[model samples]
Target: MKFLDHPSRNLFFTGKGGVGKTSVACATAVKLADSGKKVLLVSTDPASNLDEVFDVSLENHPTPISAIPTLSAMNLDPEKSAAEYRERMVGPYRGLLPDAAIKSMEEQFSGSCTLEIAAFDEFSRLLGDPAVTAEFDHVIFDTAPTGHTLRLLTLPSAWDGFMSQNTTGTSCLGPLAGLQEQQKLYQQSVRALCDAATTTLVLVARTESSALREAARTSEELAELGVGNQHLVINGVFQAVDTTDPYAVALQQRGAAAIDEIPAGLNAFPQTTVPLCPGVILGIDSLRRLGTLDSAVATDVADESVSGDDELAPLSGLIDDLVAPGHGVILAMGKGGVGKTTVAAAVAVAIAQRGYDVHLSTTDPAAHLEAAMNDERLPNLSITRIDPAAETARYSEEVLSSAGANLDEQGKALLQEDLRSPCTEEIAVFRAFADAVAAGTNKFVVLDTAPTGHTVLLLVSALAYHREVTRQSSEMPEAVENLLPRLRDPDFTRVLIVTLAEATPVHEAAALQRDLRRAEIEPYAWVVNQVLSSLPLTDPLMKQRQKHEQQYLREVSQQQASRVAIIPWQLQPPTGIQGLSRLTHCDLSTSPS
Candidate 1:
């Protein structure tokens, strides 16, 4: 509630996924609108669920919420934005340029870099141009998970610096054509973000160690970026009403322990705690009840038991299927905060335990593979992360030494300046991903991919690069050249879509599936992580939450996935070999203690 008090013109709600950023942002926007202030709520997340939360369809442009007359919402869809951006750049040259030239220009615009810059272009307009949002008194941004959001927030300065230093006037962003014209707008956006009076960054987090640690890191990083105006919203803080229920008591204790050992960096921010709601936050009425103590307890509801016919198989079955191939790429991918890293680690551990060579790697910027491994080493298993900074440096050196070897000092200087562009990271990371996939030829490569949006973009880039390789026999790495075909080959790669039994995660996973199928890649199976339906519970709040999870479980098993595996909620955080093994071998048909 304190985060809602005396808010700035711009409010950004961001944190680890599943931390209720969308719920809190929606509630705040509604409250502000109810106070008679015209507000615009925008979701910059590519896998946004504002439509589900608001129970209405949305578009790239603002759509007025039927429930709240003064509140309008929109999803800045990257694909659509990129299409518009491409048109703006290529439209004028339709007949002016040759057909082949036009096709080539369109191909250049199809990469992930274009998608990113296009979305940022839309974001910059909303934040930088006053006249664009003159009708609204406030603008609220419900951003993607921490890692993706940080990259987005840092782009203005990155692009500004890149453009200023580009003497050659050529780089990845050159395809946009009008990027230089938007330099002033990007500068204005950066100024608005850093101006304490104009923007307030709300760091949302769950009362869990991992989420809090991520929030603390984000706080420090944003501060270093000059976005010092910060507020903390600790969501889903729970207290057990039934002392006799061991599961409920343990849950409450875990939350309390996390709060007691709260990160020191978060102590400096203005703090607000939102109690855990008994059910999922959906619709305007439920949104209104958020942040209130009364909503923490469930109303009278039937306690229906989970049916036997709806039961899902254990994760071990999926691992059995995965390991049968001996060697291939296995990707654990889904929306953020759905235990992708944990699932990937568990799969790798299980396979390695079976005496197979396995390589566990992550493309997620915030992934903690070492912590997940818990310092326990397995002779057959290896772990690595595709660190963006290190990859960028290595990639830059390769490009400079190879391409710049024949150039003069001025040409080399220009090439180095081109490498400084933020888009270079995308190229470096893509190459790293390809190399990781290439390893699957000899060993099991389990990749914990980035969140939905970023993952989709990476795949899209693979498609773009694949096309480029076919068009001309360029110097693309063998791994990069073969990436898409390997991903599409069922015998070579298997993807497991991971999700919690919740609305947003399920819907987002479904969206991810659609994207993958479009890319000619079929998911091997779906893994439902952290299911509470099988847990024995006495607390009314816990039971209500349990009842609510059944619908999503059924949805996953009956509709979303042809094959499914379920992992029950752990009494303790699942980390290390023992905890992770429990996930792989959990018997969900029996009640979890």
Candidate 2:
């Protein structure tokens, strides 16, 4: 955290999910504020842990943290932010247009893009522009994961150019006056981000190969976006103080070796390393220790995990219910970095082990399916990744041939330009997902879905396409028409919301369930990955971590879902067939609560 306590007006901590972004952000903010600087910490992550970290209630505004004198914080919920932005953008048309028309217009902005734009709208005021710029000496942002943060960093220019192109008309929504002003703010935000002196983009990630690669990609993307002041903070580096424990030794070696392999793209950026503590980091005391190595590793951390052997239902239990139906779609869906691919692989492998034919596929662009399932796969199982590039190319050709076969050159050029929008990729990938779902009718299809934002957008697109067909009262394409019904059918599709045993993960998973329920899709079960409670701990720190998981484990059992499966934090990384088989045989003798 010493690398972070510098003279920057804004510092953004972003990385892959479950990589400790919130922990690092909170710890850094605490360090800076303790140095007598006025620090305003803002969390733009849809799943944020500020309240859990501070043990205090927070709103959308900067509320002074009573635990710290100079620290203030807020969580910018995307949905809430978008609703407000939508109101301001469409409020004027409310009375002018019919109620139903206004409602329809509002629905257009209710997709994931609106969430990004609205979050950016609020983000611009604090980081990009002059509003309340002087109120705090520093504004520290706890941002989302790599793909999401990268998408947002590029949004300023993307939206500005997009709005500029539509100046003449608002595409039947309304006047572009409000959006035009937003465009100017977006430009200003870009300028603020490009300036190196006042702002810094801190890439926070674990010492794993996947996390490092994602950070490097984020660094390259941010650099391409004109954000030159970048720093790579490899969080959760471990030391083998207790060399006798193979787990500790492996952890330390992995961290050290990972640092040596830093991607060339990010090698020029300054780097910070924080040693791992086995215990769960919570509240002020833990966060203070987290910011500095001296305070953190001065003494051997002791784990005071709840002195109880408690657990949830085993992963093997789901095998019975899942294998009952000879064939069905089992979808592992949740926030990014929640181990969806691994869980999907385990489920697919388990079903196949039971002599059922299972086809495992992943729609997530960042999915590591090959890593999860190695070359030595079961005879009854097969695996695939829904390649976005391949799908997009296929979709483009189909759209061009069918929709533009008779169009003139100018019209074809316009259509081609329209196909380049980000929305096109969503539709293309969604078509692939629909095809995958259709495959389940004949054989079991185990699908690992994209992150929540993208998955929700696909559902929204399906609904919109369905409505368009209904309005026209015309026949529909076979795949497009059956997409909704297939997703809505409980017997045909089993959706498992995979999550970590933590505040943000549980909250986000719950929110995901709410979103799915809105579309008439009920999750078949909840899979809690990386539970520390079930493992035997030699380190005192891990014991404390096991203690912390109790509350979340309880939350999941009593409040989150009716059927919950727990996978303990494994000593060895879950990869290949052997590692995945370990996932299905986990013990669940102890009660979760």
Candidate 3:
């Protein structure tokens, strides 16, 4: 509510995934509109949850929300924008180019780099072009961009360097000559971001070490980009009103300690805290009540629930199904903050317990794959991270040696500058992802992929990965050149889509499934993480939340996913091998105390 004290035309809420950016943005927009201001609430997340939060469907264009007066909202579909961008770039070549040439161009446009570039182009126009948003008094953005991507798009130096180069016929977004017209507009946008009077940036995070650290990094990066006016919103803060319940006490203490030991970088910013609530924040009424929930009395208790263990299948049911293949690739992917890393680690541990060799890895920037599982001592399982810093260094050296060896001073300087672009990191990380996939040929490779919004659309992302593999190695490695075919082959790959038992996560996971199917990859199963129905909680709010989860459980089993596995929320997060194995019911596991 304090964020409303000083209003700016543009408000940006950004942080690591699942930090309540969407909820906070929606609530702020509703409040501002209630105060009689014309507002446009926009979500640039590829996996937008505005529709779930507002209870009204929204697309790329503004749709008036019936529940809120003077407010309009839109969910920018980056995949759609990327598709349109590809058509515009390749449409002119129809009939003039051979079938193979046309296909190649299309594949290039389908790369993750194309998604990032096309997304930024749309983002710039939305912020830069005055005519496009002249109707609204304030524009609030719930952006799903990573810190790396944000730097590439908003930093003045990044654009300046790109403009100075002869980048035609080089990257995913087409010839550099085509981007000339947007330079001035981009510059204006950068100026607007830097102007404290016009824009306010809010960094959202959870009261957890990892989340706070990410917030700190983002805060530092954005400040360097000239967006100096910033506020920090630490969401999901819990306080144990029920001292008798050890679970509640432990939970509160953990959060309190995280706040007590705040990230150093965040110390400079003003901070606001939002209370943790069991009930999902959806609809106008819930949005208004967010962060205002009254503390539960120590004696408050409510018991109302419904479940059949056989009906609501546990994650253990799939052990045999998953291990049956003996060896292949198992990819765990979903929206941010959905516990994909935990689930992936659990599955790997479960499979490896069966005496098969497994390689566990991740492409996520928040590399918690190791932190999620405790027992790395298992000889059957090995873990690795495709770290951005190390990959960027290796990639930069390779590019400088091969691409810049013969360049003059100007060309060499430009090439070096280009290598520093955040997009370069995306490329380097992507190459590493490909290398990890290749490892699946010999053993069970468990991949904890990045969250949906920051990663490329699953539908087209696997395109020409095989061709790229061949290009990377003269004597191509043993890995399959065509990643999709291998993935499509039931004998070679399986994907487990992880999501929460909530409206937003369920809908997003459904969308993920649609995209994966389009890529000819079928999800072997869906893991619905964090179900309150499976636990015993003597709390009124928790009981209400349990009621809400049943609807999603039915939705998941009956409609959203063809095959499913459900993991109950633990009193504590499953952080180590023992905790993780419990989720999968692996042989080495013991039940959580």
Candidates' lDDT values, in order?
0.80, 0.73, 0.73
Report residue 356 deviation for candidate 3 (angstroms): 2.7
Reference-based TM-score of each model: 0.91, 0.88, 0.86
Report clash pairs, candidate 1.
none
**What's the ranking of the predictions by lDDT, best on top?**
1, 2, 3
Candidate 2 weakest ten by summed lDDT = 166-175
lDDT of 3: 0.73
| Candidate 1 structure quality by residue, lDDT tens digits, 1-593 | 99677989999888877789999999999999999999999997766889988999988788999888999999988788889988888889999999987876776677656676787788889999999999999999997223333354354433545434443233455442466667678678878888999999999999877789888988887787688899999999998888888778889999999899989999999999999998988899889889998879788767667552255888888887788878999999886678888899999999999999999999767667877888787998998889999998998888777777877776676567657665567677877888999999999999997334444444566545554322221267888768879988988999999998887788888988988887778899999988877777888888888888888888888898999988888887778889888887777654544
Q: Which 10 successive residues of model 1 have the least lDDT summed? A: 465-474
Best by TM-score: 1
lDDT tens readout by residue for model 2, 201-298: 88887887778888887777677767888888888777655566555565677677878887888788887888775556778888888846653353
Residue pairs of candidate 3 with colliding backbone atoms: 374-576, 374-577, 466-481
lDDT of the structure predicted as candidate 2: 0.73
In model 3, which regions exceed 4 Å deviation? 55-59, 66-68, 86-108, 144-146, 150-168, 294-302, 308-310, 403-411, 450-482, 586-593
> Model 3 over residues 482-505: C-alpha lDDT tens digits?
554666787777888898887667
